[model samples]
Target chain A: MKLNDEEIALRAGELGPLRQWAIAHQIKVGDYLGARDFVAVGQAHIMADTESLGAAGVDWLERWAALPAEHRLVRIPTITDPRGTDFAHAAQLKQQPWMLDLERRAIAAFEALGVLMTDTCINYQTIMPPVRGEHMAYGDTGVVIYSNSVCGARSNFEGGPSALSAGLTGRTPRYGYHLDERRLATFLVELSWTPRELSDWGALGGVVGRLAGDYSQVPALLGLDRVPSADQLKHFGAALASFGSVALFHMVGVTPEAMRLEDVVPAGTSLKTHDVGEVDIRALQARYAKDVDAVDVVVFSAPQLSLVEIRTLAAMLDGRRATIPLFAVTSPQVKPDCDRMGLTARIEAAGGTVLSGMCFYQSYAREIAEANGWSRLATNSAKLTNILGGYGYRPVLLPMEQCVAAACAGGKLT
Target chain B: MSGEIYYAAAGMGRKVRAKALVASDGFSARYDLDRIRGVFSRPEHKLAGESYQGRVLVLDAAKGGVATAWMLHEMASRGVMPAALVLNRANPIMVQGAALADFTMISGFDVDITHAIPNGAEVEIDPTAQRPFIRVI
Candidate 1:
């Protein structure tokens, strides 16, 4: 990797020990990916939930945090993904004391490093949306896919350590999605059906993701009858990234980069093409619904709920009462608006818990499942359904309305 | 005597010899692992019900969420993780995790590494080279 003067200085420990370590980390990753140079990134997002970090990761961060303030402060604007536990609702979720302790320690460490606790995967929706071709070091896969596809930003999956390094150094190794040639569509998907519901859109994403198979394949989708909403694309992109490890996608007419079919698709490029229809989405959802008639819990999360989604969920719960635990997780940025608009009240009034600043799966999900005896889970999030199986939950992927209905009938789906 | 050797585009960490756990499937520590049990727990995974602790995992590609970035370090701290990772192609998350954990990893192979290396074969990976490689001994 070619190092500029500033990078050379940082690597030589002229800047600080913190920066020296950061640059060294960047150089290693750059060398691995064959990055020719470093690209200046506008922002950085870190995903450091204690569930993923554990005690060792927290201790590692503390070691860095103990450095002098000037040495540890982030150079660029840095934010965080959802935390492992929302302190207010920790008891309700039944997260253990050790988990809460770990979350607190991790939060303190990040705060010392000057990272904002934005705690959101839907930062594109609630926070800053990057402009076309803007470079960023974003941690969450959902954030990377949405920003790259819809916002036309360039980023690879930076992860927690890499994003923090970029934040400290204000640049990242230029590779993967940062290169324009890699953005070209490698395949095509002809959609036979345009999904109406968010869950349907998510199911479509899961199907297309399975078809793409890996992070290297970018699929350009066509045949959409209308423009999908932000929330719809949110579910779709989140599920696609979760199921496939894909960082970027192009919707031929919907997304910014693929305004026309020819824009992203190279001239005369013979690409592998697949067709997705309503049955494909149904079949994908049915794969998660094996022998599940009763749900232990119903959650609307993964890529936390948008304001409009919150309103829609509140409306659905207005005249209904839930007999089982139903959780509606949203970001800290939107939680105030939900409260001011009574969306939160309406949701809580119907026996639902409106959690803020934390995603369910990231919040010690396995421990909570064990503490609550929650084996059967129902959610509107395809991403959650794809993730929770290994956590010992029988997760059922359903639409928002069906999830609400399941919550009302004491966890019975039928 | 030296056996078959395959060079990787890049690599990191120290050399080690371990039984190869070969699978032509993608890997994500968060999605396909039961961290407590030290096994592949995701039902749909090709290596479901198989133990992965201390083995060299040779897979097709890196897959799923960003949690694996921190998870490798966390898993390493608990002393329950693969001895090393050898992939045909790896996403940035896998590289980031390997870097932070200081774990042995070699990727970007010319051939399908999972198919080339047989499961249960004793393999040694030496990553301290300009062009790192793995060998079946």
Candidate 2:
């Protein structure tokens, strides 16, 4: 592949660590991207969300030199009340310095273009639907679904370049996923159980991610509900993205990109099909939960907390005191609103902690993990489950309401 | 269909009449608008749970369902068909960061109940290329 000056720019940059990271990660901007087919780039950011591990923060400038100069930038949104940490997930703030750097980088990138720097991977909620067939690049694991099914947008599971490639050349290298042929299914997922919980879908995501990654291929899931939740879609989307090289998948009744089932499965393709059952969901859940002693502390808001969630926390608290320490992290924008409404005070009064600009998993890794030894984390985010589970932490999956009750009563959702 | 109820509420401190049920999990909505019709028919109702109109009910399908549910109960305490839905991140109710709970809620049960945040088609674009891959399983 001929190297363009812009593409080779990173090889000649000043970011020593980033340069090393690029090489270690085997990243090539132009090799997989084109100059005229793409638009923006969504990357990671710092707001002390769960993905960052809430240490301090990082700046994108750290790797700006290593990334293609023309790449656009957008800040990743904060994930709140995340599920659990999987192998890929380090303790909270595991990538704090890196996150802070990413945030700064996004601000600078936004200066050059309309970089939509949101904190939540759930950017699809805002009508910024990614269209199918359009090349997209993003870093958030769970958010990948929003770009695939809901918005019918397309993109490979982008890693390093996700921060700035969109602005570097206004397009991505037409590589791996740029073509329809690559989008065909290599792995098949058969549904035997209709998932009713986010965690259930998320666990399935983990199974599929692990199973499909056998040959660095993608899976086309059949029989999932035609109308699934945005969160569920993103949850499994992110789970699969982080689980392996899987950048895209197909779902029935949803994902306009896969209008005809053949668009996803295709004909004459090598298919490895696996039938999933309720037993699989239970097994995943059981595997996720090693052994929870008792709920002494409930930490939600691995991602940034939304106002509606804050309101829910307030109502759940209802001037009551939790038996243990309960924490919920909200975005900087909604912090004051929570404070003004006394929701913060209510959560605090309930013996629970509500903090702004920081997520629990990211911020309390060492302290919580160490203090609460064997840290039986509870969450619904599939990405989190993979990260933490990989790290040997068993998470108890629960519904949002049950998590709140546990926080209030200082007990287990189970 | 046992007919699950979908509820959305802002702060339980507020109330909505119950003429119908709000099924969409639009987190942007502050309260279910269809439940408002119950306000006139059943002045005694507060959260839309006790008595049922020939047409409606209430359910909390939004984030912080606890609070939204509380509000549903407090506002339509006398109504029928009020329940709390427990969805996880995979199936989270769609409510953007800055979107106000009160803004997205509509009184009419006619809103499209499609979840726009989970699929590739729902992501926003600003002069940038769409993400080419999503690990959907």
How do the predictions measure up, each by TM-score? Answer: 0.98, 0.56
RMSD of each: 1.2, 22.7
Candidate 1 lDDT, A2-69, residue by residue in tens? 99999999999988998999999999999888899999999999999998998999999999999999
The residue pairs that clash in candidate 1, if any, are none
At residue A197, give the lDDT of candidate 2: 65
List runs of model 2 lying over 4 Å from the truth: A2-117, A160-162, A302-320, A330-349, A354-359, A371-374, A389-393, B1-137
Writing each residue's lDDT as its tens digit, candidate 2 over B1-137 gives 12223232121112232234333232211122223333212111133233334322222222211112112322233343222111111111121111112111211122222331121121111111132111111
Worst lDDT run of 10 residues, candidate 1 chain A, spans A264-273
lDDT of 2 by residue, A186-216 (tens): 7778897777766666677767766764213
Q: Residue A382 lDDT in model 2?
A: 56
Chain A TM-score for model 2, please? 0.70
Global lDDT of each candidate: 0.92, 0.44
Residue A75, model 2: lDDT of 29
**Candidate 1 per-residue lDDT over residues B1-137, each given as its tens digit:** 24999999889999989999999988999999998789999888899999999999999889899999999999999999999999988889999999999999999888888888989999999999767999999
